[model samples]
Target: MQIPRWPIATEREKELIDEVLASPHWGGFHEIVARFEAQFAAAHGCRFGISAANGTLTLELALLAAGIGPGDEVIVPAISFISTATAVSRVGAIPVFVDIEPYTFNMNPSRVQEAVSAKTRAVMPVHFGGPLVDMDRIADVAARRGLIVIEDAAHAHGSQWQGRPAGSFGLLSSFSFQNGKVMTAGEGGIVLTNDEALAAKMRSIANQGRRPDATHFHHFTLGTNFRITALQAAVLVAQLERLPAQIETRTANACKLLRLLEGVDGIRWQQVHPKINRNSWYLMLGRVEGGAGRDEFCRRLREAGVPCSPYYPHTLYQNPLYRSSPCRVTPCPNAEATIADAFWIPHNVLLGAGGLMEEVAEAVRRAILRG
Candidate 1:
């Protein structure tokens, strides 16, 4: 059977689209967009939310709102998707690479502590795939050094740590509603923060820098048109409503698969933190062990009709963009190691019923045995 892939849009999404089309205001000016902004923000325990066209822009807008500019350095985990680094670059700031914890696939808090230079203005901690970073440790370090925390919660919607929502910890946090994310609107993002001033600044920067109450053609600061449409918001609101159930199914599937693969010697799963009350399970990550080839194992799994692939092939600092840019490039052996061996099962496949997860587990077992 063909395993389901990302963006499992349903009748609810279509109905929302129809509702949007029937309305007079279809762009960012509609009531749906306003309601989505408020509801999504409140759901995450943040007082305000600013919708954006994409997650990367959300990060850039947040940085800009936090006054991150040229010469300001933001510490970023080396193991994240390239957007984490690119967002810093887009804001004319430097991204200082910090090594990740190989098992958790998140930035090592000690390395973050060491990477903070005099020019450091912020620390962007990415909750890679389904797991959260050691926010407590990172927060302590940031507090000691007076650094702004901008969480990259692209993969962490509906995820909580120590009973607090993922996006609520940072001065600013960003979430993606891209096609493959935990919640999707085809393409959209939001920045959440309790700081009213920061939220207002981000909103202004996203909307061409007009004052929140301004009606005239007056530009208050440097900004761009990064606004998300009412249609995307409508779909996202529906997705948000469905997220809890989706997360539950994915978690159950992940656990079952983990149990089935317990005796496998050549594969290991990502370590979930004890404090992670919920995991959105955007990608079920595993590492190839014992010198086994990651590609070969993934090939076997795919041959068995279970889709799988290696995670990011390269650490962010290893990319040519960082090579050419004028930024501090640090050694991240942990990130390098993690990227070289990591493979992921897309969360969408786990959404299926009818013993699909058992099939995935059997596929991995057969692949490991063959290896």
Candidate 2:
């Protein structure tokens, strides 16, 4: 059987969706959405959760809620999804691209410090695939500089570092429930924060700038429609129930896959920071050394029925959107090289029990031979 690339919903998700559809409150106004927001926030050890239409918009909401806007500069990792930087730009702030650690594929804190300036307002650290950035280091740097820290935790669902969960580290953190993410709600996102003021702002911004006590027609600020429907929330509630087990399975399978590939030469595994206690394992990133081209390696893996592709084809700054937009663009040698050498295995493929991980290992060994 072909390994599935996206999440496969079970009967629970179907039943939840159906239940929501049968309810009198069918839209985002339903109580299920509130329950989902509360449950998701509590799970991540956050005081508040505000649902959004998608992760990208959630980032924008986070930025706006934090009072980051025009003429402000936000330090961002060069290696994350384009949404990370785009959100800053959408808030009318400049995104200063910081190079990543060559091995960890996460932001280099030193580079983040170097990128700071009088206009700098915040630092958005992304928890890349397997391990998170050193949050303590980043937090120290940001605290000293008086810069706000926002976490683009779209790839991290149940990940934790040093006993602290990923979403709890930053002033504001955003999660994606896109179909490809560890947890799926088809298309939804949520922002988390412990600060009650920021949480209230985020809620208002997501709901067309309407205040809780304001008149029905009275608008509070320039907000957009980013509310997530109750149906989506219901499905996510069911999906959340399975997340712990899914993460456990993925972590175990990843360990087995690592052991299997340990003897294989020329395949460099991504380094996991020691502080990471539980890795969500959004994907498994590896580099092909010994002068093997990443393209050829990915082709071989595909040929072996093991789907693999570059974590990102290019650094976020290299995208044409940034080139056209008036944002700070800088060269990140490490990120540039990383995009060229990276190849990843989808996390969902590890869901199957039995010899699936062994099959993955065998495929990697075969690919190396072809490389």
Candidate 3:
């Protein structure tokens, strides 16, 4: 009835995919993959880029290359997708989950100081909903403390803050080209970094650590198979060329909804960074000021043919994974508070994105009035 979730690829995407299928070499590990890597490096203002199987593995590879391993602790936002912390854990390191900014949903840079210890190795911040996490502040903290900043930029593509690109601030940045992202290769991702050594190490880790120029199956480091296919690369190359228009359209639709939802009594869209001229707008967040029926409000909007929904209806710390994890024995007050109140509505990429959002906002207004 309404626009489906995201990235309803255009005819341009269709044509390009067809061409890719017709080609003999369509894997991400092929020569064209290098082209895409080079393009992504240039786009992110990085010296080198390396493609990996998916967003999670790309992040893990980056952490490994950065020399984050056993006995190390990487501080992460408690409000983000689990992948952020899981990547840290996969390399035998502990994930020190810190609370997020109530408004930004990005890691609180100030909190990292409290979380840091002798074993603290890095800070991994997520760019929640496409706005750059106060990266300059994060970078300053990391530099002063001699810790690496690994950006889980899976939500941010082409997002910038104060003229510096989102991908440039971290020692290493991982971007997802997952189906729902702004720039997707369906199931592929990349790690970007200005450091040449880190970049090469990432490359080797993604490809089983085969030493360069020696094809005798020589292994340099213990690594895994996290390389993407040629087909995925072809899809990404095509998708990259069409991103500008798609981003403009999604931004326009998000603003339209923001205008309709603001001042609607209890509900409010999440705050944007003052430096953000553009909210790449991965999702449109709305927090209920004091509604007795926040969850039901969302349910009614969905039942009214609007298809809006809540994201992270409960906090991660409430889940079995974190509640029993050895890392945290105490409750994260900020994470619990934010997750209990914060929720999201859909931001579709279809031509009907604007109208769908307007209808959903109207539905929400009615539901709240009656709640």
Alpha carbon lDDT of residue 303, candidate 1?
Answer: 90
Task: Give the residue spans of candidate 1 off by over 4 A.
Answer: none
lDDT of 2 by residue, 184-286 (tens): 7889999999999999888887888899899768888877789889889988999889988988999998899999888898778889999899999998988
Per-residue error (Å), model 1, residue 264: 1.6
- What lDDT would each prediction earn against the true structure? 0.87, 0.87, 0.76
Candidate 1 overall lDDT versus native = 0.87
Off by over 4 Å in 2: 1-5
Candidate 2 C-alpha error for residue 268, in Å: 0.9
Looking at candidate 2, what is the lDDT of residue 265?
Answer: 84
Among these predictions, the greatest TM-score belongs to 1
Q: Judged by lDDT against the true structure, how good is candidate 2?
A: 0.87
Which digits, one per residue and each the tens of the lDDT, describe model 1 over residues 223-285? 779989989998998999899899999888888878877877888789999999899998888
Can you tell me which runs of candidate 3 are displaced by over 4 Å?
A: 1-5, 329-331, 349-357
Instruction: Give model 3 RMSD, 1 decimal.
Output: 2.2
